[model samples]
Target: MTQHHQPAPAPAPAFAHAQDGTALAYQHRGQGPPLVLLAGQANDHHWWDGVREDFHTVRSTITLDLRGTGDSDKPEGPYSIDQFADDVVAVLNALGIERADVYGTSMGGRVAQSLAIRHPERIRRLVLGCTSPGGPHAVERDASVRRSLAQPDPQAVRRALADLMYSPHWQAAHPGPYRTLGDPRMPAHARRAHLIASNGHDAWSELPRVAAPTLILHGDQDRLTPPDNLPLLASRIPGARTHLFPGARHAYFEECREEAGTLVREFLLEEG
Candidate 1:
């Protein structure tokens, strides 16, 4: 017999004040141990729209808009990954959450790195997906991939993003809810700031300091943050492990949502 589950409750919008007085926006939903979701570069909480439900059944999710995205304060940013991590800390403090499991993908994963490194006590277990450490030690995306992203035509850019995000087989068979791209509502300055923060991320020397158990996930076919970074992260972060979704691309969490969710759920809920 097929199983049917009721949808998770709607998230309540809330705000937390950062040290700089920025009113960061966030939402809390469901009931269970708290799990914080961080968005990728230039994105908002909506970045997880496609996969969040997979975890909501068992974990209370807290998702925040980084300083410049979603409803968060869009201050003039020369933002840093360290700063982004602090903003998450503010949200957690506001909610009285001392520690939570953190799952961050792409640029958000970079912020998660800083979070675990800088605020070690705030994370229970860490999940980094489809992201790089970002520095001289990290593998950079191919120049061709960079050129495709730099396309001037919007349609052309969309196509390029589609190619980067999903596998060819998946793209041919499915009409994707591709939430992998940056948020559209971002202003020019906010976008630039986000890009700067993402590019400037460098936690190579600090990964070993992350005390939380870490799981690094990625798609084997990922073009943006290549799967090469998976082992790099696994090797750097003490006791870190990795899982690669075969034939999947950048948005492997969405491409293989159920399986990925199960893997993460098992990892997060397991007894230490």
Candidate 2:
């Protein structure tokens, strides 16, 4: 009989906390200026696993699983963007960080915007990746997509993950990570809560209040938050700039991690 071999399992990430005692999870890597990364909706801190190595070349990186997701505490609904922003501040405080650059994606971008607006003292610079100001134009996800997300069917969830995260060619050539996105641990309630936070968010008027130097990154091929939205965001915030990644989708960071990290590192290092 032939001998069989099994692959070793990946090590699980670490956990931390916000000042409010809400359990939060995060993975820390690298060794320089701190850069706190807030991940997109329905995802965990591990979402940054692919890019963490790249970021370490420039600065220390911390990627947190926001409250109610991944290894974090799943406090009941009624969660708001403000609450999430506070969570970021609390985490910074708990870590004894006076200030750090912030990078957020999708829903995470909204939270980063809120942090800049409400807790400007904590943020040194801001990077908004594949996100939009929650307004009329931001409501671009198709009704069928919304319906499928609402149903909580396993197959539907898998398809939705692929549609949101990758281009057709990428999906066809590499489907493993996309399929793992439907891991049973991601509950319907968490998805609903994330949607509630995204839909209820209205940061358009608050854009002008963001004082930190900001960089808005958008994918030209992003279906969820269209590229047009990036200009609107750039125009509103003082000293805000925008970048469009060609042939990239909403998961621009995952698809172009090194390029994105390079852009972000250069932007954050710029002196005003």
Candidate 3:
């Protein structure tokens, strides 16, 4: 017997406009409580391709490239975390979504924090993964990873990102994501602007002001943000909790999609 699988439901109202008139490209998938997915800094929407099916399976997810990456407008330099937050708001408004559960990874987590602090009413629950709360006190990655980000060639840049993002075993096990990971739309300057924006992101004082329930997820083997940052986030934000994934790196969600999805779904539904 030949059995055909049912096609997944599509998330409608794909495109949206940013406050600065930048045409932000976005896609919505699944159905339930609206969940906005913010990617890492300098990472396009495609970065979430591996684990998206898990999150989208139970709830509506809004995934978009934050201005400088992917198909989003790469206007000049001087981008800030606040600006990225506004871009998220623009997309939610365009979709007529009043509030949403937010899940952000790496630099995208910075954007989520800014949104929660700046626009508290817009978020239902916050999920931050493999990111840092920047400032003079913030712990940084190794110098080599920083240098890799500044590389002139995109291939080298991606290679550097992989080194900083994934554990060696994970890489050897799954090579397709990196092999096909290529985005020519992001210029070097735009990536620099993203790094610049991420600089001095001191949410230390502002985290206490975030009014939404929060969950912080991190990988034990993460080299970029370091697993130590997880405790800082959980302690700073009021009533925030954390989850640690052993043997996982920065891309913990993707590495452990099935488990992560169940945790997230339960949190959003039961906690929030």
Candidate 4:
């Protein structure tokens, strides 16, 4: 007997205009309490591909492409973290969502910090994964890891990223292709702008103002954003909690998606 599997529901895509009049692309998927998933530096909504399905089981996710990547407008540089947060607000407004839970990783986590700080009323719960507060207070990765990422060859850089993002055991168990650092579709200028914006993020002084309940997550083995940021975030964000994934790397949420997703869902659903 040939059994037929139902096709997965495609994301409903739409566009919203930021305060700067730049167009941002967003997709809505699943059905439940709203949750916004923000991408990392130079990445698009697809950055959540690895773990979105897990979250979708318990959430109605809204994912958007920040100004400089994917289906969004690629405007000129000097983008700020506040600007990225505002862009997210624009998308939420377009969807008529006043407040929602937020999950962000890497640069997205930085943006989430700005969002909760700058627009306090708009966030219900916050989850930050593998990200930092930046500025002088932040912990920087090792020089060797930095050098490996800065390699001139694109393939070499990707290989280095793969190692930083996944564990050897995970890689050995999964013999498929690995993910890249950023969106290949992003223009060079936009990527540079994203890097500058990401590097400029500094919310340490402002973290105490975040009104929403927050959860910080990271991989013990993460080298990209480094695992140190987890405690730093939890300590600064008032009443924030934390979780560390053992043997996982930068992509800990994906490497241990099931466990990560369960923690997130429970946190978001918990009473204030």
TM-score to true structure, per model = 0.95, 0.88, 0.90, 0.95
Candidate 3 — which pairs collide? none
Query: lDDT tens digits, residues 5-110, model 1?
Result: 5545655679999999999999988789999998888889888887786786679899999988889989997989999999999999999999999999999999
lDDT of every predicted structure (CA atoms):
0.89, 0.76, 0.81, 0.88
Candidates sorted on lDDT, descending: 1, 4, 3, 2
Q: Candidate 4: deviation at residue 126, Å? A: 0.6
lDDT of 2: 0.76
Clashing pairs in 2: none
- For residues 1-272, write the lDDT of model 4, one tens digit per residue: 11223437655569999998999999998799899999888888878776776776668999999998988999988898899999999999999999999998999999999999999999999999999989999998989998998899998988888899889888788754754368889998999899899999999999999889999999999988889988988889999999999999988877887788889988988998
Encode model 3's per-residue lDDT on 1-272: one tens digit a residue.
11223535544436688877898888887778789988887778777767676665568778887788777788997999999999999999998999999998888899999999999999999999988888865678878767877788867877877866777787889885652143557897897898899884889888999899998999898888888889988888999989999988888887766677778878988754
Off by over 4 Å in 4: 1-12
Q: Give the number of colliding residue pairs in candidate 2.
A: 0
For model 1, the superposed segments whose C-alpha errors exceed 4 Å read 1-12
lDDT of 1: 0.89
Error of 1 at 199 (Å): 0.7
